[model samples]
Target: SLSLRPANSGKVCSKGAFNSCAECIVSGPNCAWCKKLNFTKTGEQEAVRCDTQENLKTRGCSETEIISPKNIQQATQKKPLTRFGSFVDKTVLPFTNTNKEKLKWPCQDQNVQCQPPFGYKHVLSLTSEHQKFNDMVSKQFISGNLDSPEGGLDAMMQVSACEGRIGWGNSTRLLVLATDDGFHMAGDGKLAAILDPNDEKCHLDRENLYTKSNLLDYPSVGQLAMMLDKSNIQPIFAVTENVKSELQKMIPKSAVGVLSGNSDNVVKLIKDAYSSLSSSVIVTHDTLPDTLSVAYKSNCPGGDKPGEEGICDKVGIGQEVTFYVQVTAKECIKPVSFNVGPRGFTEKMRVTVTTRCECECDDPPMKDNPHCNGKGQVKCGTCRYDCEEGYLGQRCKCSAGQRDEEQLRRECRKDNGTECEGRGDCVCGVCQCHETEGGKTYYGTHCECDDEHCHKYKSLLCGGNGRCRCGKCECNPEYEGNACHCKKSNEQCKTGQTVCNGRGTCQCDQCQCSRGYKEPMCLTCPGCTVPCQKFGNCIECLAFAEGPFQKNCSQACPTTKVKVVDRLTLSTEAKKCEVKDSKNCWMDFTMEELQGFDNYSVEVLREQRCPEPPNIVAIVAGSVAGVALIGLLILLIIKALIYIKDAKEWKNFQNEKKKSKWTNADNPLFKEATTTVANPTFSGE
Candidate 1:
C-alpha cells in the first residue's frame, strides 16, 4: 500500500510501500495487490502477502474489490478521520538548492518571475515536466508512430506515477486526459497480465507493465470514475466528439474536439479543454474541510453574488475572475489542502491552511522622534513642531528665504528676511508700493521716488493743468509750459495778448480756434451778422452776395458770420459798389445774428440798395392808384353816353310832334282818328 503523510513529516513513502495484500489493495487506487505475496510494505520484510490467490484468500482479501466514494464517505461519516497532512513549518525548511531549482524551472523560459503560490512550488516542476512529456508524445506522433492500441492511456498512468513521486503537500490533484481514440484501460492492453483473475492482483515486470499491445480489456466507465475519485484526482477528459458524451457520464466535466488522429490533435484538444474550463467554474469537492470554511467572491459571469461556493463562474475570453479564498481555521491541526480554480487548468491553486496557534510580533515600537529634532511635541505617534508662525509641511519646516509663521502666508523674503526688497509690502508673492498721497504720486519697482515732472516752474506735477500722459505733459490751452505752466503768446493775423481769444488749443504754439470762430486767432466770421454794423452801407456784401467784398466784410467787424445777395439796377454806381453796372445790380441784404451771449440766432434786415423797401412800397401804391383812375374814367364815359341818348330821344319827340302838326294840316282825318281813339278808351272806364 502507498501511505501518505503531511509534508512536514520527516519520513517519505513511494508507490511500492505496502506488502500485505489487504493493505496494498485498500491503500487508495494507486496501489494494487500482487497475488504473489512476495512484496513487503516495508522492504525489510519481503515475501509477505499476495504471492498467490490462495495466499490472498488466506488473508481474507478480495482482489476484485475497489475503493469508491461511497465507501470513503461511509468511513468518513463514522468519525472525523484525519484526511489532511500535517503542517510543515516553512521557516525551518531551508530552501535547498534542488528545491529552488525546481521552483524556478520553466518560468525562466517564459521570462516570467518564479512566483508560484507559497507552499505550492512543486506546481512549477510538475507542470514543466508534464509539458515536456506531452511535447515528446507530440513529436513522436508527428514524426514517428502513435498507432499503438493503448493510445495515450499510458501517459495518464505515468502522470499518476510522477505525482506519486513528487508529492503535492496539501494540493488537489488534476488529470487532464486527452485522446482521439477510445482509451485502453486495466485489461484492454498487454498490461492486464499484471492482475491475477482470482484476486485481481497486478503483476508487474521491472517496468511496471507488459510492453505488448492488445492484451488487456478496457475498464468500464464506473470503474474508472471510482479509481480516479479514490485517488483524489479530478479527471478532465478531452475527447473526440464521439466519445465526449460517454466520458461526460463518467467525468462530470469534459471538453469535446475534432481529432485528426495525431498527437497534435491531442495537444489541441487538451488546450481546448483547458480553455473551456477557464471560461466556466467546475468545483469538484462536495464540501470543504470542517475545521476550515471558505467564502468565495468571483467577479465573473454568474459569479457576482458573494458568499457563494468555491466555484468561479464563467468569465469572458481575456477577462479575469478573482476568487477571494478566505480561510477560517478554528483549531490548529494538520495542514489542510483544497483545490480551487477552473476545472482543467493545470495552474489551479492548492490552498494549504497553516494555523499559527500562537502569535509573535514582528514590528516593535520606536522611541526616538521620526522627523522633528527634540524641539517639538509628539502626539498620536507623529512628531509635530511648534512652527514659529507661517511655516507648513513636514516638520513645520519653512522654505529658504521665507518668513516663518507670519499669518500663515508663505511670503518670499530677502536674505535679511525683509519682504518686497524691504521697500514694499508683500501681497501674495509680489510687491506693492505707495502710489499716491494727496496730490503727489510715487513710482518705481519699490516706490522709492516721485514720478518726474517739470521742476523749472511753480507746477506741482504736469503744471497742475493737464494730467501727465505717459510721463509727457498734455498741456491746457493758454498755458504753454512743457508741463502747462507758461502763458501763451499772441501770434495771429493781428497779435494780441490772448491766444484764440482764450477759446482754443495751441499745438506747436499755434492757435486752433474754437468752433463758430476761425482764422488767425479766430478774429473773422464766415457770414455777416444781423444788421451788420461794419458793412451796413455795402448792401451786396450784407445781403450775402457772391462778391469778393462779402468774404472781406466778415473780417471788418467783431461779428461772427457774413452773407451776400445779388443786386439789380444800381441807383448809384459808386466806387464802393462791387458791381458797377446799373442793370440788375441792386439787391438786398438780410442777416442772422448770434444775438446774445447764449448765441441765439436772430434774423435782421441789413441792407438793400436796388428795389429797397420804400421803393417797393411806392411802386405798389402807384400801380393801385393807376388802376383806380382808369376805373373812374370808364364810369364817367358811361354816364355821358346815357345823357346823350336822353337828349336825342327828347329832340326826336319834338320833331315827331312837329311832323304830326304838319300831317294834321295835310291829313285832317288821321289826326281826328287819333283823338277819337283816345276818347273811346276813356268812355269804357
Candidate 2:
C-alpha cells in the first residue's frame, strides 16, 4: 500500500533565473522564461516567468514548454539509521535475542553465546570471534606498524583460518568483516605476512611483522563475497561512512553499516545487521554430493524478479510460508545427508535423499541354495539356476515322463538314441523325415506313405488310368500298365489310320511328330512360306530380262527418244540387274515357280521440274516492321497511363489546396487588404 508521488507534474520546462534561454534552462529544471517581443524588462510589461504547466498556460505564452527527460530522475527512498543508544526498534522486530545482557561479552568467554534455538550458533560465535579478533588486532599493533591498511588480504586470511572449524551443526554460519579502508588481496598484503604467493601460508606471529604494513593490496569486494559464500558464510561489513558505500557496492544493503570510531558503535551495528538479516525469509542449501542436484520454489511476501530463483521474501512472525523443493539425481546412488535452513541462522533441518535403481530381492540362501541343488548363483540381487538334463525351473525337478522311472529314457531325436524311427532327422522333441532323391516326401510323423509321387501325364498321375505307390506307377490292365506307357486302341494317337501321318510313332496316347511337320501331324512345311508376292519368282524374270529386250519401247511410244527403267525384287536369291537406262526397252517372259514368290506387276514413272529457293530479304523486312509496330503500341500505352495518373494527382492537389484554411488569403493577418473609412472624425473635432 506504499505510494511515492513524483515531484514534477509531467511538464518539460519551467521558470528561468537567467537571461539566455539555454543558460536559464540548463541552470535548473525549475527555471522557465517567456520570449515574447520586448518583454525582457522586469517592470509591469515584462513577460511572466512560468515554472509549472498551469502558470505557463495562464500567461497565454506563444512558445510551448520544453520537457527534458534527462533532467528528470526517480526519487529514491533512504533508510534511516538506528538511534545511537539502542539499535533495536519497532521497525525491526526482534526474532532473535537482542537483549543487552545476552550480547555483553560476545565471543569473549565460552559462556557468552547466542541464546538457544538460534539459527546460526557458529555464525553468532564467529561474529563474536571476529569482534574478539578485531579487539586483539587493535591492541597488538600500533598505528605505524599497520602498513597494509587498505587491503583486507590479512582479514581474508583470517577468514581462511576459521574455515572448516566453523561448524554448521544445528545452526547457520555467519562471517562479519569490519574495516575502515579498501580490502587488500593475497598478493597485495605485506610480504612478511604472506608466507608464499604461490602457496599462501601466513606467518601472523613472526617474519618482520612491523614491515607487514603497506606491503599488501586490498582484494576486490566481489572476490571476498564469493569466497565467503563458498564456505556457507554470510559476510557483514561494518565500516566508517567513508568506505561504507564502497562496501555496499559489494555486499547487500542490509549487510553494510556505518561504523563509528573507537569501536563504540560496533556492537550496535552487529545487532542491527543480525536482526535485519535473520528476520527476512531466505533459502539455504546443505553441502550436496556430486550425484545430486536441488532446486527451490518460494511463495513468500514480495514478488520475485525475472532470473531471481531461490530467493525468498520477507515474512512476519508466525506467518506460515511454503517453499516447494525438488531434489534430483544424476544416476543411481545411495542415500546422502544434507541440511536446509535460512542462510544466516544456526537452526537447520536435516533430511536424506535416497535413490531406488536396484531391486532388493529376497536374501540369498545362507547355508546352501536349494535351487539347482545348491548350484545357483547370486548377481545384482537375483538368483540364477542352471538345471541339468530332465529337470526344469529354479528348483530343478524331474520332468513329467521321467518321474515314474528309475533311469532316464531317451526321446526320438538325432542327438538321442532313437533317431526319428530311423526314417528322418529329429528336431526338438519330435521326428522329421529326410526327403527321397525322387522328391517323394514322407508323412505320418515318420517316413510312412507316398501315394502322390510318380511320373505324370497331362498333369494327371499315371495318365489318370492308374495309381501311384512309393513313387512308382501301377496302371490298370486296359492301359498296358508299364509306367502307363501304352494306351487302348481307341486312345492311340492316329492321323487317318497312320500315327503321326506315317512319319512318327505314338507314345503316351499322343503323337511325337517327325521332321518337316508340327507336333501331332506331319502336314506343314516351314520352307514353303511366301515372301514378297509382288515379285513372282524374281530370279527367272531377272535372267530373261538380262539376255536381251526383244523390242524397244519406241514401238509403243510416239517419241523415238524415250527412257526405259526396269526394276525387280528377287525372293529366292540376292541379285539385282545392273541395267539403269534403256532406249525404249521392252521384254516379255514367264516366271518360274521359285519358292516364296506369288506374282509380280510393272509400272513406269516420269521425272518433274525442280523447286525454287526461299526469299530471305522479304522475310527480314516483314519481321523488322512487325517488331517496330509492337514497340510503338507498348510505348503509347505507357504514355497514356502516365498522363492519366498525373491528371488525377493534379486534380487531388487542387482540391486539397482549396480545402485548406492555412493559405495567406484565408489567414486575414497574413493577407494584404485595404479598408477606407469615409467621413471619419477630424483630429481636432
Candidate 3:
C-alpha cells in the first residue's frame, strides 16, 4: 500500500520521509531504506523507513537491513581473437606509359602498358600462407595506369564494402595502401561525366575486379572513414613524403608511414606501425545527453592522471587494465544508459544509471478524523474531505455559501495579481475560464494560455501548418518560422538542376550567395572582368610556360583551348581582352565561351603590344632645345622685370616731384647742403 509524494525541503537523503524500500532508494543516490519493522518509534509515521545510510545506522538499523542501489556495467559478448589477419593492398600508377626497360618487375613482367585504356587485374585474395602472398605480389600483382590523382579512394571503398570477395574473417582486418601520389575523392568524377555517386556497396566482378571504377565517383574521405570504422578495418598508409601529411590529416586513428625512395623499407614500416597501434588503447563512449557528464580514470602503463579520456598506451598482451568511470547528472534526470569500449573493437561495456527524485509513503486512511470536523479521513498526515460538493478549506470547514471569498480569490489569481489572468472569473477557489468568440478556450490552471494568441502569417494562424501552445507556435518538421510560414525544402532555390548553382545556401526560400556570385539562383557574376584578365596567370602558364600556375597549368585551366594568331579580331560573340605579361607588355587575345560547354576558346595575338624602343638621339636633342628655350624665357622674364622696375622708379620720382613744396632743381636740401658746407667751413654762412 505504498504511495508517492514530493520530496521535502532538506538534504537530498536526510530523514526517513519515504514508506517503501524502492521509494527510499529512488529518492536520492545517498538514500537507503530500512527493512526492520520496529525501526520507527510508536508515534512516527511508516515513512520513517527511508533515510540516509548513516542516519539509519545511527538510529540502530543494521547494515543488512539497508537497501541502496549503485550504477552497474556489464559486458555481453567476448569473442576469441583470431590468428590470421586479412590485408588489402591498393597500388596507384601514373597515367604516362613507362618504358619496358625502365619499368619495374611486376608492371613490366605482366606487360601492362599505361594510360587512357587502363584496367585492373585481381591476382590474389586474403591468404594465410605468407610465401603464397609474397609469390603473388612478386609475380602476379600487376600495376595498372590511371589518371593522377589516382583512384585509391575508390579501391579503399571496394575493399571495405566487398568483404565477401576479400574473404575477410572474424579477425583484425588491415588495409595497406602503398602509393607515391595523392588520391581522387568525391566530386572529381564530374570531369569524366560520371554523375553517379559512390553507393558504398560491393561492385566486384566474378574475377574480383572492381567494376564501377570509372562509372561512379570516388568515395569521400568521411565516407571512407565511416566504412572503415564500421567494418572494423585498420588502415596503414605507406605513402611518399609528399602525401604522408595529407593522408594522416584525412584519416583519423590511422597509421601513416613515409616510404623510402625505392620503398625497400615497407616491411619494417608496416611492422613498426602495427606494433605501435596494437600497444595503445583508446576508450570511447556513445553520444550522451547534455544533462549527464562522464569521466574516466584508468590504471594504464603511463602515469596517466584521472579524467584523461580513457587512454592507456604501451599496454602489452595478456595484461588486464581497470577503468573507473564516473557519471554525474547536472540536473534532475531519469534513467539513462550508454556503451563504452576500445576505439577499434566491436565489443562494448554497457553502463546504466538511474536518478532519485520522488519519495513514497504507505499509510492507510484513518476513518473520520477530528481535524476534518468529522467530514474527512486522514491519510499520510493529510486530511481528505468527504463532505458535500462545493466544500473547501484544509479541514472542509468552508462551503460555497460560507466560503471566505477574499482568501479563495487569492488562490485563483495568477502570478501577475490578475484574477484568472483577466480571462475568467474565480468561483469556489478555482478559475472558470471564458471561451473566445472563435471557439478557442483558455487553458492552464490560471487561465493564462490560449491557442488564438500565437503568431500569424498571411492572415493564417501558425501559417496553417502548426499548432499553437501557450502563445507560441510549434512548427511542423517541414516548416520553420515564427509563424511556420517558411518551408525547409530548397527546391525553389535551385537554378536548373543545381541548388543556387552550387555557390550559395538556400534559407527561407531565398538564396544566400557566396563568393562574388549574385542571386536569385547565384548564376551570374557581374563583377568578373575580361576573360583574359580573369585567367591571365593560367593562360600565361599554359601558352608561354611561365606564371603563377606554371607547375599546375592543367589543373588551373583544365578546359581552355589556346591558339596563336597573327592578330586578334573582335567579333560580336567573342570578347576582346588585353592582358599584360610579366615584361609589362599587353598581349591581345579574343576569348569566346563555347556554347553548351564549360570551356573557353582563346585566340592569342602573335605580337605583344610592347612599347617602342626609346629615341635616345631625339631625346637628347629635345632636352638641349628645351633647356635653351627655358634659358631664353628666363632672360625675357628678367628683362621685363628690369623694365617694369625702372618705369616704376621714374613714376614714383615724378609723383614725389609734383607733391614736393620745392622743385627738383631748387631743392630744400640744396639750401641745407649749402648751409652745412658753409657751417663745416664758417658756422652757417
Candidate 4:
C-alpha cells in the first residue's frame, strides 16, 4: 500500500492502451502489452495489444510474446556513506530566562546560538573552533523572559526544510535538540492568536532572528518528520524522561535520551546518540496501505534473523549487507511504487509492483449453441444450461428418472464398489473428481488415485529420488521401497562367514539385527563365545615367538598374517585377546574375521608385559628391619603397662590411707599427751 490508490487507477488498460511494452508498463502497473504482431482480430481495436496480463495470456499470447512488467528495485546511487564530515550546529532557544548561571554551562561548548531581541534567532552557523563557539555562547547572547510552551516544532521545521542554509553535508547528519520541557504543536498556536500554519521556509532576517516567529503556527509532528526525512537529517532528542515516550511515538527513527535536570550531560548524550545512530542501519519504506504487508530478511552483521520491519544492528563501517524484501498483498490492489532505504541516507531503492486481476478472453453469452441440445447458452467455449426439471448432463439430455440415476451411479463406482472412490460426485453418468484446498485434484476414471496422494519419504514425494506415478512411487535403480526411502545395495550385510553373521536379516543395505546380536552388520553376538580365545595360543606363538606352539608356529597359525605394532587398536570387525605365554608374559593382539576365507589379519603389541626378577637383598633387609621394629613396639607396650599398674596401685594405697584417717593423728590415744606437750609449748610462744 505504497499509495492511496494505484498509480493510473482511473485509466483502463484496454481504453487507451499503448502499442509498445515500455509505454504500456508506464501507463499502468497492471497493463501488459503483447509482442505478437498479428495478435489483434481484423475488426478489433489495435489497443487490444494492452490489457491485464491474464487477458493477453488467455488470448493465445505466448509467454514469450506477453510483456508484463514485474516489480523492480533499482539502486541509483551506491556511493558509500561518508564516515566523517561536517555537520550544522544550529540552536534555537524555546523561551528566554534571566537565570544565566543555569544556561551558561550547557551552551558554552556548543556553536551557533539563536539569540534575542527575538524569542528565537539563528546565528554564527557551524564552526569547529571552541574559543569562537564559547565566546558566542558566553558573551554575545543575552537572556529575556518569555512564555511557557516553547516553539520547538517551528524551529525544527525551519532547520530541516532550510538545509542549504544550515550547511548539511552528505554524511551522518544529526540534529540534537536538548529540551527539559514539552514543546508546542500544530493546534497550540491558536492560543497566541496566530493561526497561520508553518510554511517550512527559512525566515532568518539580517540579524539571523526568526522574523515570522509570531506569524506562523507550530508545525505538526508529521510535518516535522517529513521535512527531516527529505533533508536526510537524524534528530536526537535529549529530552527529560517525562516527555521522551510521547516524542518517540511522534517521530519515527528519532533517538531519545534522558536529559539531566541541570543539562550537565548534554555533550555526553549527543556523543552517545551519534555513536548509536551511526553504527546501525535501519531500513524503512514509505507508508503502505493496510492490504499490503512487507517483511525483511537480511544477512546482517550478527546473523540472518528476519525483521518484520527492516533492521540490521551492530553494523560496521563499509560492511556490505543484503536485504530480501517480501511484499505480500492480501487483496488485489492496483500497482503502486515506494522508496526504501536506510534512515538518514539520501540514496534509496525505488520499487514498483504490479497486480493482475482479470483476463480479457471473457466473451459475452451466445444463445442456443447446437452442442447444448437447444437448452443452454455457450460462453467461453463452455455450456451454461437452463434446463427444465429432471434434465441433466452437458447437453441437458439425461433425465433424472430412477433408472438413469442408477446407471449413472453405477458408472462412477470403482473396482472396490465405492462410488467415485468417495472423492468425487457422479453427474449424468460421469465422475467429476474433487479438488483439494491445496489445488491437488483426483483424476482417475473412478476418482481412486492422484499423484499427490502417493506415500512420501523424508517429507518429499518419492523421497526426491524418484517420481510418483498415479499414487505409486517408481524409484530409481539405486533405491527401492514404497516411498523410495531405502537404498538397494546389500554390501553392508556381508560379514565373516555369512550374511548378517547368520543372526539377522538385511534390508535396504542395513542390518536388522535379531535379539542378542549387535548392530552394524550384526558381526557380534553378545551371548555367543568369540574364536579369539581358541586362537590365542596360536597368535601368541606366531606374533611373540613364545607359547607351546612356538616351535610349530607356521603350522598352528597358518591362516593368520601377524604384524607387530607398538599399540593394538580394537576394531568393530576385529576381536581382541590378551593371552599368557608359558613364560607368564601377557600378549595383546587383534584378529579380524574375514569373509569367504579362513585367512585372518592379526596385529600384536610389540611390547609384552612380564614379571621382573625379585630382589633377595632388599627382601632380607626389609624382613630383619620389620622384626626389630616389632620387638621394640612390644617392649614399649610392656613398659607402658607396668607404669600404668604402678600408678594405679599408688593411687589405691593413698585412697585407703585417707579412708583409715591415720595421717597427723598418729598414736592418738597413747602418744597424744607427749606430742601435745611439745606442740603446746611451740604454739604458745
Question: Whose TM-score is greatest here?
Answer: 3
Which prediction has more favorable lDDT, 2 or 3?
3
Runs in model 4 lying further than 4 Å from the true structure: 1-116, 122-143, 146-151, 163-173, 179-208, 217-233, 239-246, 258-264, 286-293, 301-307, 327-335, 343-346, 355-685
Sorted by TM-score (best first), the order is 3, 4, 2, 1
Segments in model 1 whose C-alpha atoms lie over 4 Å from true places: 1-155, 164-180, 185-219, 226-241, 260-268, 282-294, 316-319, 325-685
- Rank by lDDT (best first): 3, 4, 2, 1
lDDT of 3 by residue, 548-597 (tens): 88888888888788888886777876888878987778878888765222
lDDT against true structure, model 3:
0.68
lDDT of 1: 0.42
lDDT of each: 0.42, 0.45, 0.68, 0.67
In every candidate, how many clashes are there?
Answer: 46, 43, 1, 4
- RMSD to the true structure for each prediction, in A, is 47.6, 48.5, 24.6, 36.1
Model 4 scores a C-alpha lDDT of 0.67
Measured by lDDT, the strongest candidate is 3
Model 4: per-residue Cα lDDT over 1-685, one tens digit each: 1112224433346446353345565676677777564464322334557778677786678766666544333333233222111111112333433356534433333555633333355555655565766666555543323544566677777677666666565555778787666777887667667779888888867765667877887789888988887788888988888788887787776788898989899889988877777778878788988888777777775436756666777766667777777778887777788877677876666776656453222233545546556666533222323444566554555666756567778888866498878877887766667764555456566776666767888799999878776789888888888899997867878765477766677778877787566888765557855567677788778877878897889987787788899988898877787877777887888888653234578899998889997899999999999999999999999999999999999999999988894447555466433543355456553
The clash number for model 4 is: 4
Q: For model 2, state the Cα shift of residue 345 in Å.
A: 6.0
Model 3 — which ten-residue stretch has the worst lDDT? 81-90
